[model samples]
Target chain A: QQQVKQSPQSLIVQKGGISIINCAYENTAFDYFPWYQQFPGKGPALLITIRPDVSEKKEGRFTISFNKSAKQFSLHIMDSQPGDSATYFCAASMRNDYKLSFGAGTTVTVRA
Target chain B: DTAVSQTPKYLVTQMGNDKSIKCEQNLGHDTMYWYKQDSKKFLKIMFSYNNKELIINETVPNRFSPKSPDKAHLNLHINSLELGDSAVYFCASSSAGGAETQYFGPGTRLLVL
Candidate 1:
């Protein structure tokens, strides 16, 4: 069973457009939610993360909207650029737990 | 400097052969983990070690063994490799403990022929 589920297995967005990816989790014990971005031939890097205590968190052009009640979260990239094209993965884990359950990854392509 | 690094970026070996992948981290993190990514891009956790102590071991087969000689290094050894063992393995490290941000290595692509 997949603990985390992400939508839009693949997405295409125009330059300067907004790119959004959504994810949901079934485990209520998961308190930490993180998003990762991966480029071709490279490992994934942490993008942004949020906890259930807050409804949203923004860093630069990236924003994470979280809904604890619904067990859902979404990542929005404002003014998406061509360089932002890559794969994104959403993961959830509980505090003090070493295991992280990752979502099936979404490949994003930005058209110039 | 690379925070996490894995050796043998690509490996192709025959079935039943024994192979080992080595990983090292320079971040001085107290926790390290091993993850496997399948062709469908599904990433799954295999094992986790903290301060050279085994902490997490998933439902992986007994043929797979993880060794940590010290706090800075973790290695995976597989005996009698099977075709299904083909996948990309990644090593990650985090400061403090679990539920923290993790730094990942580039990855090691293994192909069991």
Candidate 2:
């Protein structure tokens, strides 16, 4: 079982509010978790990532909460801005593995 | 400079036609991969190449083939294109080896009519 499932196919939040997206994986071998942000007509870019060793990782306004035992993770954007509106995808992979299992994806719209 | 780049951002072709999409990476990554995103927004891996060697080949149709002339380049060639082949194809690359951050190309939107 190498699937990563994400919830809330789409989300809408008011500007300056908080946007949260959740993801879960069935593969226990996954050690690295990454989130990606994609804009219309553009490639998906790495937003933030966390490892099993860390419970949480924050970079500026983006934060990732990871639970190793539960095999779940989530992405939180504080003070969400309209510019942050895009599709977010969560993926999991193991060390020395080239294949990355990805979730369905979540489209977050921070309206102004 | 663009870390990853793909040619023919949009392509429209008839079924059964053969077409090729080219990809290049300037990020000096040793590994590269190809992913297909369907109309339903599901992204799936098709093939992966590391240092010009075939590494991962998913359960994709035989009509789809991947070629890597160099470590920084990977191309996808589709023979006998079908209507189901219409989708966005993305090319991504990573540095060092596995479990590394990947850089993606803008993507190529293919429409098989």
Candidate 3:
């Protein structure tokens, strides 16, 4: 069973446009929500993360909006660029549990 | 210097053979993890170690074993490899605790024929 579910398996956005990916989780114990970006043939890198205490966290053009009450979170990329084309994975984990439960993944493409 | 490095970036072995992937981190992190990424690009954590002690084992097969000789080194050994085991294995390290930022290695692509 997939603990975290992500929508729009693939996304295509024009450069400078807004690209959004949504995720939902059923585990209430999950307090940490992190987004990872992976390029082809490379390991995943942490993009942005949010805790249940914060509704939103922004890093540069990447932002993570988290709703603890709804058990949902979303990633927003502002000014999408061609270099932003990659796979994005949304993950959740409890404070005590070190293992992260990841969503299937979303492939993002930004056309210049 | 690379934070996390894995040796034998590509491994191709026949079924029933044994193989091992070695990972080392220079970041001096106390926690290390091994993740497997399948064709669908789903990253799954197989094992985690903190300070050279096993912390998390995620119902992986018995054939897969992880050994941490030291806090900075973690290695994965597989016995009787199967075709289904073909995937890219990544090693990552985190400081402070498991909930901290994680740095990942490039990855080791393994193929079991």
Candidate 4:
């Protein structure tokens, strides 16, 4: 069972553009949503996270727009750069869950 | 210093062989986890150990086992090598309790023929 669903398995965007990736989960008990970024041959690092208490949280060029009622959350990278080309994953977990349930993964390519 | 690191970044072995992928974290985190990313790129947790204690063990086969000799180290051992076992294995560590942010290792790519 796929708990979290992410769209557009692969995305290509131009530099200085915004790169967006969306994810949704069926479990309403999920309170924590995090977006992770991974470059080739490296581990996924935490990009941004949302607690569901706020509708939107922005940090510099990264933003996470969350909709609790819609069970959807999207990550927006403003002014995307070619260095941002990598795979991204959206994960969700309940407050008590020890393991994170990750989405399939989205490969983002920012063309120079 | 690296937070979480895994040894043998690339592994290649034959069927019916045995291998081990070692992981260590200098972050002093109590909880460590092993995640496998398949060909489809779906990352899933295989096992988790906290302070050398087994906390979470997913529905992985018995051939796969995790040994935590200490709080900072958790090694995964595979009894039998198979083609289906090929994947990128990641080791991650985190502080606090559940739902905490985790730090991940680069990953160990395993290839079995």
Candidate 5:
């Protein structure tokens, strides 16, 4: 069973536009939510992360809006650029847990 | 320097062959994990090791075994490889306590024909 579910398997946006990806999880034990960005032929890198304590976390153009009660979180990329085009994954893990449940992943395409 | 590194970036072998993938972390982390990504891009945890000890072992097949010789190295050995085993395997590492902020290797793409 997939612990985390993500929507919009793939999306395309124009440069300077906004790209949003949404994810939800049923596991309430999860506390740490992280978003990873992966490029072709490369490993997924930690783009940003958030704790349940906060409702939202933003780092530069990447923002993660989290709703603890709703068990949902979304990633928003402002001013989307071609460089930001890649696969994005949302993952959730419990505190002190070694396993991270990942979503199916979303492929974002930015057109220049 | 690569925080996490894996040997054999690509492996192509026949079915029923035995193979091994090695992983090393230079970040001085104590926890290491192996994850497999299928063709559909679904990632799942296979195993985890902490301080050279087995911690988490998911519901994977018995043909797959993980060995942690030391805190810095974790290797996976697969016997009687099947075509379903063809996928991308990634190695990751993180600090001991928090166990978050994992750094991943470039990944090893394995193809069993």
Candidate 6:
């Protein structure tokens, strides 16, 4: 069974527009939430992460909004660019656990 | 330098054959993991090693075996390959402890005919 659920299997956005991806989980033990970006023929790379303690975290144009009570989190790409087009994945894991449960990836296409 | 690396970026073999994928990390991390990404882009963890010790083993088939000769290397060997075994295999590593970042390799694409 998939512990994490992601929406919008794929999305397209105009340049300079905003692209948002959402993910939800049911495991209360999950305390670490991370977003990953993957390009064609490349492995997924860590984009941004947020803990349940904080409601949001921003790094450059990428932001992660987390809601502990709702057991949900989202990734927002501000000023989406063509270079940002790739597959995005949301993952959850316990703080001390070595396993990371990943969601079905979302493909984002940014058109210039 | 590459933080995490895998050998044989692409592999193509016939059914009933045996193959192995090798992974190495130079990030001085104590934990390493193997994940499989299916054609539908669903990623799942298969195994994890901490300090060359098996820490996490998901419900994977016995035909798949993961070996860690040291802290920096983890190799996966599969026997009696089948068509359903085709997928992209990724290797990742991280520091031991709580909520550390994981660095992933370029991935090995395996195709079993």
Instruction: Tell me the tens digit of each residue's lDDT in model 4 across A3-52.
Output: 99998799999999999999999999898898988888899999889998
TM-score of 6: 0.97
lDDT of 6 at A26: 100
Candidate 1 vs candidate 3: which has greater TM-score?
Answer: 1
Tens digits of per-residue lDDT for model 5 on A12-108?
Answer: 9999999999999998989889999999888899999999889999899999999988999999999999999999999999887888889999999
Ranking by DockQ: 1, 2, 4, 6, 3, 5
- The lowest-lDDT stretch of 10 consecutive residues in candidate 6 chain B is B95-104
What residue runs in model 1 are displaced by over 4 Å at the alpha carbon? none
RMSD of each: 1.0, 1.0, 1.1, 1.0, 1.0, 1.0
lDDT comparing candidate 6 with the true structure: 0.94
Residues A1-112 of candidate 3 have per-residue lDDT tens digits of 8899998799999999999999999989888888899999888999888999998888999988988888999999999999999999999988877778889999999999
lDDT computed for candidate 3: 0.92
Candidate 3 residue lDDT tens string, B1-113: 99999988999999999999999999989999999999999888999999999998998999999999999999999999999999999999998554678899999999998
The CAPRI-style docking tier of model 5 reads medium
Q: Where is the poorest 10-residue window by lDDT in model 3 chain A?
A: A93-102
How high is the TM-score of chain A in model 4? 0.98
- Winner by DockQ between candidate 6 and candidate 1: 1
- Give the alpha carbon lDDT tens digit for every residue of A1-112 in model 6: 9999998899999999999999999999998898989999999998998999999999999999998889999999999999999999999989888888899999999999
Q: Give model 1's share of reference contacts.
A: 0.79
lDDT of every model, 2 decimals? 0.94, 0.92, 0.92, 0.92, 0.93, 0.94
Give one digit per residue, the lDDT tens place, for model 2 in B1-113: 98899998999999999999999999888999999998767789899999999999999999999999999899999999999999999999998454788888999999999
For model 5 the local lDDT of residue A71 reads 94
Compared with the true structure, the alpha-carbon lDDT of candidate 5 equals 0.93
State how far residue A44 of model 3 sits from its true place (Å): 0.7
Candidate 3: DockQ?
A: 0.70
User: Over 4 Å off in model 6, which ranges?
Assistant: none
